[model samples]
Target: MSFTLAIVGRPNVGKSTLFNRLVGKRLALVDDQPGVTRDLREGDARLGDLRFTVIDTAGLEEVTDESLQGRMRRLTERAVDMADICLFLVDARTGITPTDEMFAEILRKRADHVILGANKAEGRAGESGVLDAYALGLGEPLRLSAEHGEGMDELYHILRPVADEFSERAEADAPETDLDVSDDAPEDFTPSAKRPLQVAVIGRPNAGKSTLINTILGEDRLLTGPEAGITRDAISVSLNWLGTPTRIFDTAGMRKKARVTDKLEKLSVSDGLRAVRFAEVVVVLLDAAIPFEQQDLRIADFAETEGRAVVVAVNKWDLEEDKQDKLKALRTGFEKLLPQLRGAPLVTVSAITGKGLDRLHDAVLRAHEVWNRRISTARLNQWLGAMVEAHPPPAPGGKRIKLRYATQAKTRPPGFVFMCSHPEDLPASYTRYLVNGLRDHFDMPGTPIRVFMRSQNDKNPFKGRKKAPPSKLRKHLQGRKAD
Candidate 1:
C-alpha cells in the first residue's frame, strides 16, 4: 500500500543529498557537480510511520540537440509514469529560475500529485526561494534542511495523508479468510536464511580451474593432478568470500562433442552445461601456455550467450618467463578470437603458486559488481552521446541509422536494449563499436558484454524469444516470396 515518490529538480539543488537523507543510506553517489546523478535511483524510504518507495532522479535539463536526451526521456518518463506522486525539490537559497518553471510545466503535465519542496530552508537566506517556490502554483512548499535533518515533522505530516489513504484502500481490498502459515512445512527441509551466489569454474581439461578454485577455498577440496578427465562429476562446495556466502562449482573439463563418445562423458558434459545455467558468474579458466584455444574461446562465448557474468583467468603464470610477451599474446588472442566478449576481464594468475590470487579475486568481484551494475538513464545516454559523436551508427537504406535510445533491459551478463529506427539495419560492426565503448568507459575489459537491438516502431517481446530457435526461423523462411 506504500506509495512511490520521485524526487526531481534542476542540477545542484540537493536532490541526491535529500535522497540520501530520506533513504538513510548513502546508496546514491553524492558529488558537488551539476550532473553527478545521471540515472534514476530507487530505494525504500521511511519517515515516522509513513513508509514508501522513493526514486532519486537526475537534474532536469532541457537538451534537444544532444543525442543522449532520447534515452534520458525514456528513463525519466518511465519513473514519472510509475510513480503515484512526485516531490519537486528546489534550492531555497538559489530562489526560482526559468529552469525550475520549465520543470514545473513538465511535471504539471505528467504527474498526478506534485509536492513542491523548499530545501535548505533553515535560515533567513533561504526564505526568498521558499516564497518563490509558491509562485509555481504547486502548493505551499515544505521547508527543510536535508543535510542538517531539520523539518522532518513537516515532511511526515505532508506524506502521512497519502500513506493513510493508500493503506485504507489496501485494507478494503484484503481477503478475509485466514489459513495456517506453516501447514506445508517439511520435517527435514530447513531453509537456510542466506542464498549463496552460484559460480562455475569451467575451461578445457588441462586448464587449472580446479587449482584456482582450491586456491580460492584455501583447501584441497577438489582432486587436482596433471591428467585430464580426473574430475568427472561437477562437484560443488559452499564457501564464503570476504563474508559473502558463495557456492563454487568445479565443473568437469568439457571436450569437443565429437570426441565425447562414452555415455558417462556425455552426461558429465551435460552436467557442466547445467552448472553454467545455474551459475550467476562463470570464471572461464584458460591455460597461459596455450591461451585462447578454440575450446577456451568457445567456453567464454557460451557463458556470454547464456547471460552469465564471465571472467577469464589465465592460469600457471608462474611458469611463464616472458610475462609481458605472454600477456600481450593473450590479449591479442582474446581480441581476435572472442570479439563478442570484448571487454571481459582477463586475470593472469599462478594457480599453482598462488601469485596474483588477490588480483583475481578483485577482478572477479569487479566483474560481478559490473554484472549487477545499473546506470541511470541520464548517465547512460551521456556516455551514449559521446560514443555516437565518436562514431555514429552506420548508413542503411541510403540514410543514416538513428539509435534513438538505450537502456539496460536485463543484466547478469549485462544485456542492454538499444531502441532505434531500424533495428535490422544496425550493422554488427556498429554494435561492436558500442560494446567496446561500454567496456572502455566502464573499465570492464575482458568481460562478456551484450547489446540487443530493437526497433522503436514495434514492441519488443523479449520473452519466449529465448526459447525460439534461429534455425527454425531460417527453415520456415527458406524459398519464401518477398512480401
Candidate 2:
C-alpha cells in the first residue's frame, strides 16, 4: 500500500492551497470563508519523485455539538485516523493560535506520525510566526508558503523516507506474479477487477445523496443532517462493494438553474456537473415522495446528453407506505417523463436505512454493461434493414430518401452512423424511430444511443473547379465571348 498523508490545520491557513499545489489541480474549493471545506477530499499527490495519496480535510475546530462545524471537525478527525502521517499546518504569518495548539496536542496523541508545517512563511514578514510554531513541540516546522510555491524541496526531503519505507513494505507484501504464456486464448474485452468502477451519485438538494453514499461506505464518512445543501463539493470515496472495487463520487445537491442565484451554489452545481461528466456511471437519486420532478427529468436528460450510463435511484423508500402501488406509479411516471431513459434501471433505495442498495448496485453494473456493449456490423445492418422495411423513409419533395447502410460507430453509450441519400431531409421523428428500434432490437435498454445520418455522396463540390476571375478579367472575358 502507498503512504497516505492528511493535511490538518485551522481554517483559512492555506492547507487547501497546498493540497491543490501538490495534487496539481485546483480541486478543493477555496474562499475567504473559514469552513469552505466541510468534508475530507483525497487526491493522488506528487512532489518531485515521491507520490502518495493526500487528503485535504476540514479545518480543526474545538466543537463537539451537532452543528456544522462540529460535524466537520469529526470528519477531519476520521481522516487523521485513516492517514499514515499527518501534516499539521499552522499559519506562520498569524502565529499559532489556541485552536492550532489544541489540534497539535490531539494529533500528538492520536496520529502515529506527524509533520509540522508553517504555511504563509514567504519572507521575513512571517519569520517571527514560524519561530512560534516550534512551541507546538511536533518538530522543526517546515517553513513553507503554499501560495508562493516555496519550501517544496524541504517537504520532499521529509516525505522521501516515508515513501521509501512504504514502497519496501508493499514490495514485501506483493504476491509472486505468474509468467505463464497462453497463445491460444482469446483476449478478454471485459474490464479487469483491478480497475475500480467510477460512479457518481447526484440529485437535487436534500435528496439524500450524501446519506446514501454514507450508507454505502457503512460509516459517517460524509456529514449529513436535516439541512439542505450541506455538501458543497463533489467528494469521492473508494470502496469494495460486493467484491468489486468502486470509486463513488458524492456530489453537492444541484438546484434548478433559475433558482440558483448564489455564486457559491453555482460553483457547487458546476462541480456536480463535472463529476457527472467524469463518472462512468451516474446514479440520479430522487426523493421517493416527490420522484420524477422537473429537475429530476432535467438531470437525467443531461446525463443522456453526455452519453453516460444512467441509473435512477429513488431514495427515502422506507417512508413510502404503499410500497407496491408507489413503485408501480413511479415506474409509470418514469417511463412517461423520461422516454429517452426508457427501460433504464430504476431501483428504490432508502439511503437512511440502507434498503434496496443491492438492487441499486446490480442495476448500476447492468447499465454499465449496456453502455459498453458493441454490436457487430452485420447484425446492426440486419436490424437496420428490418427496421427500414417495417417503416420506410418518407419521400420529401418527390424524392424517396434511401438509407443505404448502417454501422455502429462506437460504444459507451453506443453511437451509430447511417449512410443515406439525403441526410438533411431525415425528420426528427424518423431518427427517433431508428434509435428506439436499435435500442429494442439490440437489447440496449437504458443506455443513451446516438444515430448519425451521413450523406453517401462523398464527392467535393469544389473539386476540379477553376478560380473566379477578377472584375477586369471578367469584363475582358465577356468582351472576348461577345466577339
Candidate 3:
C-alpha cells in the first residue's frame, strides 16, 4: 500500500486547491465558503516522481456540540487518524487565527507526524503571517502558494524522505514468492477473476445515498444526518460484499440544472457525473415517498444515455404503510416514466433499516452481467433475419430497402452493425424495432443496445463510354430493305 497524506485545517485555507494541484485534477469542490467540502475525498497524488494517496478532508472546527460543524470536525479527525502524515494548512493572508491555533494544538496531540504549511505565502503580502505560524512551535513552516504553484520543490524535498521510508517498510513486510514452471507450459485462457466492480450510488438531495452506503458497509464510515446535500464530493469506499470485492462511490445529490446556481454545487454535480461515467454500474437511488420525480427521471435518462448499467433503488421503504400496493405502483410507474430503461432492476430498500439489501445486491450483479454480455455472429444474423421477416423494411418512393446482414460489433452495452442497401432510408421506428428485438430475443433486459447501418457501394464499370454510328447504318439498311 502507498503512504497516505491527509490535508487538514480550518476551512477556506487552500487545502482543496493544493489537493487539486497534486492530484492533477479538480476532484474536490472548492469555493470561498468556509465549509464547502463536507466529506473526506481521496485521490492518488504525484509530486515529481513521488506518488502517494492524498486525502482532502473537511475543515476542523473547535466544537464538540452535536451540530453540523461538530460532525464535520469529527469526520476530519477520523481522516487524520487514518493518514500517515497530516498537512496542516493555515491561511497566511489572514494570519494565524484562534481557530488555527486550536486545530494546531489538536493535531499536536492526535497526529504523530504533522507538517505545518502556510498557504498563500506568495510575494511579501503574507510574510508577517508566515512568521506568526512559527509561534505554533511544531517546526519551521513550509511556505506554499497552492493557487500559484510556488514552493512545490520544497514540498517535494520534505516528502521524499517519508516516501522512501514507506517504500522500505513495504519491501520488508512483503512475503517472498517462489515458483517453478516448465519450458513449454500452455497458456491459460480461462477468464481470471475481475477487479472490483465500480458502482456509484446517485440521486437527488436527502435521498439517503450515504445512509444506504453506510448500511451496506455495516458501519458509520460516512457522515450522515437529516441535512440535505450533506455529501459534496464523490467519496469512494472499498469493501467485500458476500465474497465479491467492490468499490462503491457515494456522490453528492444532483439537483436539476436550473436549480443548481451555486458554483460549489455545480462543481459537485459535475463530479457526480464524472463518477457515473467512470462506474461500471450505477444505482439510481429514489425516494419512495416521492418517486419518479422530474429530476429522478433525468438522472436515470442521463445514466442510460451514458451507456451505463442502471439499477433503480427506491429508498425509505420502511416508511411506507401500504407495501404491496406501493411496490406494484412503483414498478408500473418506473416502466411508464423511463421506457428507455424498460426492464431495469427496481429494488426497494430502507437504507436506515437495511431491508431489501440482498435483492439490491443481486440486481446490481445481474445488471452488470447483462451489460457485459456478448452474442455470436451467427446467432445475431439469425435473429436479424427473423426480425426482418416479421416486420419488413418500409419501401419509400417505390425503392425497396434491403438489410443484408448483421454482426455484433462490441459488448458492454452490446452494440451491433447492420449491412444494408440504403442505410439512410431506414426509419427511426425500424431501428428501434431492431434494437428492441435484440433486447427481447437475446434476453438482454435493461441493457442499452446500439445498432448502426452501413450501405454497400455498387458502381457501374462502363460509364461515359460513347457508342459508334453503327446504329445509323443499321437503320438505313433496314429502311432500304423495307422499300
Clash counts for all predictions: 9, 0, 0
Candidate 1: tens digits of C-alpha lDDT, residues 5-123: 99888878888788888889765656665655544667778888778988877677777543444344455656777899888889999999998898899889999988899998988
The candidate that achieves the highest TM-score relative to the unseen native structure: 3
Q: Which clashing pairs does model 1 show? A: 39-376, 343-445, 343-446, 343-447, 344-445, 344-446, 344-447, 345-446, 345-447
* Local lDDT at 407 for model 3: 87
TM-scores, all models, native as reference: 0.52, 0.91, 0.92
Task: Evaluate residue 358 in candidate 3 and report its C-alpha lDDT on the 0 to 100 scale.
Answer: 94
- Model 2 residue runs over 4 Å out of place are 172-193, 458-483
Would you list the clashing residue pairs of candidate 3? Answer: none
Instruction: Residues 238-258, candidate 2: write the lDDT tens digits.
Output: 898876679899999888899
How does each model score on lDDT?
A: 0.78, 0.90, 0.90
Give candidate 3 regions above 4 Å deviation.
179-195, 459-483
lDDT per residue for candidate 3 within 1-483, as digits (tens), equals: 589999998889999999999999977887888898888888989999999999998888878888888889888999999999999999998999998888888899999789999999999999999999998888999999999899899999999998899999999999987877465856332122346888999999999999999999998778899989989889898888766678899999999899999888888889999999998889999999999999999999999999999999999999999999999999999989998998889999999999999999999889988898888989988888888899899998888999888988887678999999888988999999998888889888887888899987667665556765578889999999999
Query: RMSD for each model, in Å, please?
Result: 28.2, 5.3, 3.1
